[model samples]
Structure formats: structure tokens, C-alpha cells
Target: MFKGLCRLTSVAALVCSTFSTALGAESGKQVYTGTLGKTPIVLEVNADGGGDVGGRYFYQKYRKDLMLSGKKVGQTLVLDEVPLRGDQDAPHPTIRLQPKPDGWSGEWRSPEGKVLKVDLQQANIAPAPAATVPFLTTLRDQSPYEYLRLQGLDLKKGKAETFMGYSLQWWIEPKSETTLFEVVSGYTAAERQRINQQLMGRLWQEVAGKFDCEASAGETFYAQTVEPLWMGPSTISVSIATEYSCGGAYTDENDMPLNLDVKTGKTLTLEDVLWLGQGKPLHYEREYNDATPSSESYDAYSDYRTKTLAPWLVQQLSALYPDEMKTTTEREDGCIYGDEQPWTYPSWYFTKSGIKLVPSFPHISSMCRDTAFSVLPYNLIQQHPGSAALQLP
Candidate 1:
């Protein structure tokens, strides 16, 4: 399924590139290059074309041999798409580094294949080029989507601007109604709303049944935005601003469901901040609820073994005397039942399938006269020795 979709998406790319390139020009580069730790890694555009992605060497620290394929549309460097070996989803295009008489320069393409013209001819030529200023690249698609409206400024083709003496990049772009008939077909908005309300009511009932609910309410709103970033190989830097609002929340005091502020806004709550501080914690992991589940309820392994495991046994017993194996059917209550049982000595027989057991008694039956046949040894082994048992009875 994924393979088919990927193929379809790739084919779709040919026609989609035009609008995507224009819309894409607004967002910067998706793929990027930088360091993982101390080791330098060339991060490039992935097939999904979202942002900077690392290759196998990103982990092993193997710098790819930057082989120049030639120029694209003149002085523009053309990079070869190297088939990377490692855990990457697909191979990516290499960063084409074009060296002039003075310094190295190149153009970087975002994941979407929209190229960002870059030049570092005048910067200080040290061992390697440093990422002077980052740009607002592309807004990544979280999932498969349509109507991708990338919100931001625009740039012209064949035109160039400088940031810390570098150019900015660019790129671009449920329902149900049915009912049990109507109840199942929720085909209209009203029907869907009714269904959703009923569902939420039932869910709340179940939750309230399990635990006391101090409040109950919900709100719905829509939001979108474009965030900027400075993504190198290993290190990632970015800024985000979102527009959103809470629909509503239910509380016991409001018999008339009070609606929360349904308005859009933005808050920069310290997500894009990272520090290599002194004596500070290397990693400060955080979780939402702000509390941890207690471990005291857990028992030791030995306790579980004695209480839930030890003394449990399974055994198979040989035929008590001898038995007759038969397949028979009967009408029980109203259902027709099939039986596979062994007829034993005296007059009783039993059959079982999985967890069900059956008891039956046949009056002599047609086998009484020929019961003396000597198939006893096989029957004893197979638990079908009714012939041998009938001889005694």
C-alpha cells in the first residue's frame, strides 16, 4: 500500500512541481547539512522533502566524497543523487559545492526539490563554511493533505538576496453522514453533530461511571502557521508562532454550558530554546501530567510465580478400560449438534471439544452383535477400544 502511494506521489510530482515550486519558493530549504555531535555530516533533502535529513554516515560520521557532477543552467552546481546506505528511508541529492578562484559556493535544494541559490564567496574561508544565518524554510506536512496553503512572503526567480551574506530559500503546497440508515448514515452536518454529541455523551457516561467527573465540556477551533529554523546536521534550531483557541470546557457550576474564549492567538512558551549551560542537566526530560505513576502496587517476580504459576499441571491419561470412538449427531433443545465421543464400558460415553463437554448413553445400538471383533490393541492406543470392552460387557 505504501509502495503504491509513494509511486503515485512520485508520478504526481511531475505536474505538481510547478505550483509547488512557486508556493515552495516562499518556504526555505527542507533538507540541510550540519554536524551530529562533533563529527560533520552532510544532511540532505529526503524523499518526503520535509526538512534536513541525515544519511547513514550521519551516525557513522563518514563525510561523503563531494563529486561535482557539473553545472546546471550555467554556473549553478548540479549535485548527484547518491544512493545512501543506512537507515534512511531513501537516498538524497548531495550538496553541490562549486569552488571559484577565491572560495566555495553552491545552491541548496529543499526537500520539495525547490532550489535555494547560495553564495559564500566573500565569507572568511576557514577549514569549512559555517551557517551564518538561517532562513524560514518550509512548513512540513504532518500527514497526507490537500489545499496546502503555505503562509509567508514571496521572492522572485533569478533574483537574489543576502543573509549574513546568504540567500533565503523557498518551496510550496473528513466527513461522514449515515445512520442505522439515518443513525448509521450520518450524512449531514446536523446528523454528524448529533452522532458526535451522542458519542461524547456515552463516553462521558462510561468515564463518569468509572470515576467521578468534576467537569465535562469541549471546544473546537482551527489554526495554521509557518515556523522558521536553522537546522544543521545534528543540531536543530527553529521558531514557531501558532494561531488557536479552546472551544469550550464543561464544569459543574455551569448548567448553561459556559463557552471558553473562542479566539485565535499566539504564545512563545519556550519550545525553541536550547542551552549548553554550565553544570546544567544534559537532558531534562518532561512529560505533560506533571506527575508519575506509583510503583508500590507492583509485586516481586517470586510472588507472581507462587500465586499465579506454581502447581499448575497438565496430564493425559490412557483409556481406563477400552472405548469406542464414534462421530454422531443429535438434536439438543433446537440446535443440531455434532458429537465426537468415545463409548466406554458399562453404558456411558463422553465427548469434548475445546471447553465444551457432552455425555451420552446409547441403548445397545447396532454394534452389540459384532462387538467381539479384535481391534482392541489399536483401540487401546487410540482410545477407541469399545470392541474389546463390549466383549466383557
Candidate 2:
């Protein structure tokens, strides 16, 4: 696999430009299947009239987007690579191709003067196909998909196992150690498919994100552990902890919990399970990749999470689990998970008995966040449940 997405050089004149190739913009774009020398690629060139040419392409093997731009020079279309944000050293390649009876044929030349033969033929791509689109095609389908496919995403299914009476299949990106679990049995085929889509889409992001990081900084050291927290009848949940270092001064670590409603294939949020806000529950992130949440909406959500829910959650947990809530120097310099400060906006997942919440802490107290001690009983979650019609076990 390619180490990273190529970037633009210091030249500002040859920079990437903005153009929408969204859901219904296929008319404006033309897809091509060809090769830049021996390597295969799927190129998208602008089809809207005039000599001005632009679009993007991905290596058939890499499945990552590399932008292109330029205009027609007589019979030949001359295009320059539009470098994205990445490493300092970019080849800044250029392509010169002339339209032939079948398609287009040209030469790909790099800044270093290395040249290779370029050949291309239009590809039939559908944003919305009648049948199940191949995973490779969906990599750049540009459809209103349930999940956003990132550049350099290579999804591979690994390990088949059983957890809590649920048949599990793991989709893994070995390089980054990114793992996503798919429920293989239990529900109808349609329901299982919907769930698999969600899992695979997320897997794409994790893998692509790693490739992106490596491309920008070169050879990132990434490791992830997917902990299955729940595989109950009503909910499927997992917690992912990632630690990465991409030529940085220090490694960075973060954790996220994915909780999906087993029935509807919807991601369940903290507010969805337990909310004490007088106003409506907050949307922490977009439900789908295509959504554009305004800054104002995000600000309101931040306020609600910090001001409203954080304190209320602490109060509730404190009242319920007073012993666990008590802070002592014994635990990671007194960085307790039940501490009101850290528990304010925790990443949580569902469990058979209760809700397992892990606190967020400063780098100095990261160890405290590792141990999940603040668990809220299912009884409370059922009391102030949000809009989702969930059956609490």
C-alpha cells in the first residue's frame, strides 16, 4: 500500500482547487480506467465544456484520491498534479495526454524528469446503482453513502469468533492495527447487511486516517485495541483506544466508544441513553458523513454537554456510587474516574449490567482514564432516555 497521499509542493500556483463532485454531480465529471505506466488507476476528469480540465484519480491498488487540474492544449490535455496537504517533498507530477479513437494516451512526467506512458479509458461508475456496488467502486462512488470513505482505505476482513452469543467477524487494517467487528448472525440478512455497512465504513475511516497521517508525516507508529463492551440483544457496542506517533515529539492517545442500536443500525449517543437537560438532547457529531453541522449548533452542544449534562451526571453517579466516586491519592495521583471534573464528558458504551464510562483527562492523568470505574446503573439510563426507542436489558 502507498505510504501516504501525495501533497502539493511549495508552489502555490499549482494548488488544489475546490469543486463539488457530490451526489448528483456525475454529469460534470468523467471517470476513466487506465494506467500511468504499469500501475493501474481510475481517473476522473472534468467533463463540463471548455479547455479547463480538473478532477481526481486513485490508484486501482491504493484506492486513494490524487487531485489533477489543467486545461486542453490543442489536441492534448495537459494536467498538473494538485498536491494536497502532506509531506514537504512532493513529486508534483504532470500528465500530457491526447484523445485517441478509443480514449486518451499520453505521458506522465515527474518533477525529477522521470517519465512513464499514460493511457486511459472512461469507466462506468454509478453513484446509485441498482445492485450492490463493488467495495472498490464504492471507494469513489461519490454517492450519499452511509459512511465517508477516506483516502487510502484498505479494508480486510479478519478473525471470525463468537462473543456473548453473537457471531462476530473482524474487519481489520493490519498496518494501523485498526479493527471493526461485524455481527455475522442473529438478525435477518437485511439487518445484518445494514450493520455490516456501518462497521465496514467505520473501518475504512480508521485505515484511511492512518494512511493520511503517514503521508503527511511519514511512517506513523499506530496501534489500536478494539474492546467489545457489549453484544447484547438490544445493543452492540465496542470501545477503541488508539495510540499513534507520526514523527512527533510525543505519542498521542485517544479513545472512542461506538454503540449501535442492534435493531435500527443507528449509533447511540450518551444523551440518547441518559439526558437530564431541560432542553432537547444534543447532537455531539453528525449522524452521517454528508451532514454539515453549523458552528452555532456545535457551540450549543458543547455548552449542554459541559454545563448541563456533565454536572448532572456527576451528581447522579455520586449519589448512586458514593464509594466509587470518592477520590483518593491511591489512584493515579487522585485522578479518579468518578471525579466530577473528568467524568464531565466521558466516552461511554453499554454493558449488560450498566453503562461503562471512561473519563477524559490531561496527559499527566491519562492512566486514570484507562480504568473505567464510573458505571451508571441501567435503571437511571431508562429513566431519562432520549428519543431513541431502545429496550434496556
Candidate 3:
């Protein structure tokens, strides 16, 4: 399952192109909007003078970037499209443009010798993506990618779902769909409203990131799903799985779990549920929940994660699932579930049986992630509750 470690999951630019837009500066970069024939396109060009010109362009409909790199000849720019696969020697499309009265007029020639008219004019940058939800950037900072992707989309509502007697309505948008649910019966009316707002905000982040990544790479792969793992008088917990390729070397996936307090609707963190810290656990900053602590405090927290918490998890899970704890070979692609190395930086969620620990591994061993072999029983939580006053079943 895919989750947003909030690993600050980044969407990088491929070649000659980046996730940058024109915003009140002449940083050698300019954004243009026009048409490659009948197809509308957004183009960025950097003419910083060295006779070198580079940028990215995407069809407005597709929203996937096509890298551009070439040279400026007199009054014209001759930009060759770089292969998305990074094969410089491979055949690609080419664009030649000269300054016009309004913007730039160009011709795009395909490798197959087909030619098309390319007309581009300066694009007026729109306001940041505040349309989905108010203060949408609270969960994570907005990027040029977000603005570029969201500016054109008109989100519509999809079907609603009733799960375990709970009503959840789908707020539909692409490159994915998400839901919003109010805890009418489990929590107080006011608290439920607040909790629903928080849930919707988080869902917006997940869905928005999906669209952002999707737009970044025209051929980008993206999918997301949220499953209610456990919903009770204690808390409502859901597992969000996101699998996407956002202009990276390879595709990525993660499982970000959301656990909420029934009474307060407060989103529960690992530190809130199970802290092995000496005194104060990872501090939750003012607004951003994914925000990290300073170096000194973070060093201590790292010690607790790697040295204290991870090893204990190894022991606890080993006693329960001995077979799963073993790793074969990197070549064999065996997931080492018991390896305390990954458990240190805990990725956990509330499960029906217990608190399930999801381990993260490097690219080669990424198959080792989300194995779900390690779950600490709820009875253990009853015995050793963290600083949180909430009760768990």
C-alpha cells in the first residue's frame, strides 16, 4: 500500500525542464500559452543569453511535460525535444520560434517529418490553488506543479459510499477520487464537523498531489485509494494508498494512515498512541503535522526510533510472526520484515487487531515495505498507553 510519508514526496523535472513558472521575475525563464496547431500547450523557455535555450512544454489536455533544449540563432530559438527516456541520441521532435508582435510564433516538426504550426503567447499566471479547500496548502506547501495542474480543472462530486453504516460522499477529481465523511454518531456534532474538515483537508492534499504528479508527467502513473481499516468509539482510522510516478527515476508507492480521536477528532500520531521517548516525544508543531523537530531534538528522537523503538518492535513481532522476519537475498527480492533497520522510522496505523507497523526500505528492497507482519496488540496499548488520554479497543 502507498502512503505519503509526506517523505516530502517530491515531483522532479525530467531534463531541460523543471517545475518552475513565471511569477513576477525575469529569471531567464518565461511561460507561454498558445497552440501546437489545434492542441493548446503551456511552454516555458529559459533564454538566459549564452546562446543556450531550454525549457519544458506540455499539451494543455495531457499536462505532461516534454523537455526542450536547443540554441538561439539570431532572432529565433531552435529547441529540440529531449526524449522523456533520457536518450539524447534518440530521435525527437523539434520546435523553432521567433519573437512575434504579441508572443512567439513557432513551427513544431516531428521526427517523422510531419510539421505543425506552433503559436505561443505569454501566459498570465493564475492565483495559487485555493479553490479546492480554503488554506489548502496547510498540509503541505503548494508548488508550481499544483498551480499548473489545478488551474484548469473543475472538480465535480462523484458517488457516495456507505461503509460499516457510515455515510461517506465522494468528492471526485482527477487524477484520482477521494471521499469526505462526518462522524455523526461517534463524536459530538461540533467535534464531528471539525473532524470532517480535517479529514477533507487531508484528502484534498492526497488528491491534489495526485493531479500535480499526473500533470507533471503526461505519461505519469497515478492511483489512490482510501480504506477504512478501523472505525469505532475509540477512533476512525483509514489507510491511504498512493502509487505514482512523478517525474522520478522510478515509480513510488506509500501508505499514509490517518487515525482520529473519537471525542476531539484530533488526528493521532505514533507518538500520541505509543511513545518510547524518555519524556517529550516528537513535538507536533503549530500547523503542519508532518513538520519535523530541530537537529538536537531530532537526534534524540532518532536514537529512540533506531535504538529503542525499532528493536523492541523486532522482538514483539518475532514472537508472533517468526517466519516473516527473515530476509533471503536482495537478488531473490525477499522482504526482511523483522529487520529493525526499517522499523526505526516507524510507519504505523491503527488496525482492527492492533497497531500495524509498516516498514520502509530502499529502492532495491522496497518490496519489503507494507508487509504488515508486525502489529502490536491493543491490549499492549491498554497496559502501556502513551501520553494521549484517548482509550483504544
Output the number of the TM-score-best candidate.
Answer: 2
Tell me the lDDT of candidate 1. 0.23
- Candidate 3 off by > 4 Å: 1-34, 45-54, 71-78, 85-91, 96-141, 154-159, 174-221, 243-253, 261-267, 283-300, 318-335, 361-373, 382-389
lDDT of 2 by residue, 96-175 (tens): 98998657899989999999998986553333222222332344454322112232334476889988888988766654
Error of 1 at 63 (Å): 41
- Write candidate 1's Cα lDDT for 1-393 as tens digits: 111112122222322322332222223322232333244332322222332222221211222222122234344335554432333445455555565653335655546786654443211111111111001010122201011111111112222323222233322110011010011231344533333232222222222221112111223232222222221111111222122223233211101111111011011111111111223212212221123333432333223223322211000111321222222332223211122122111111111111011222232232231222112232222332211111111
Instruction: For each candidate, give its TM-score against the true structure.
Output: 0.16, 0.70, 0.68
lDDT of 3 by residue, 190-278 (tens): 76665665676676666666655754633577777777777776677888887777777787777777777777767777777887667
Please give the range of 10 consecutive residues that has the lowest summed lDDT in model 2: 2-11
After TM-score superposition, the amount by which residue 177's alpha carbon in candidate 2 deviates from its true location, in angstroms, is 5.5
lDDT scores of the candidates, listed in order? 0.23, 0.67, 0.66
lDDT of 3 at 217: 33
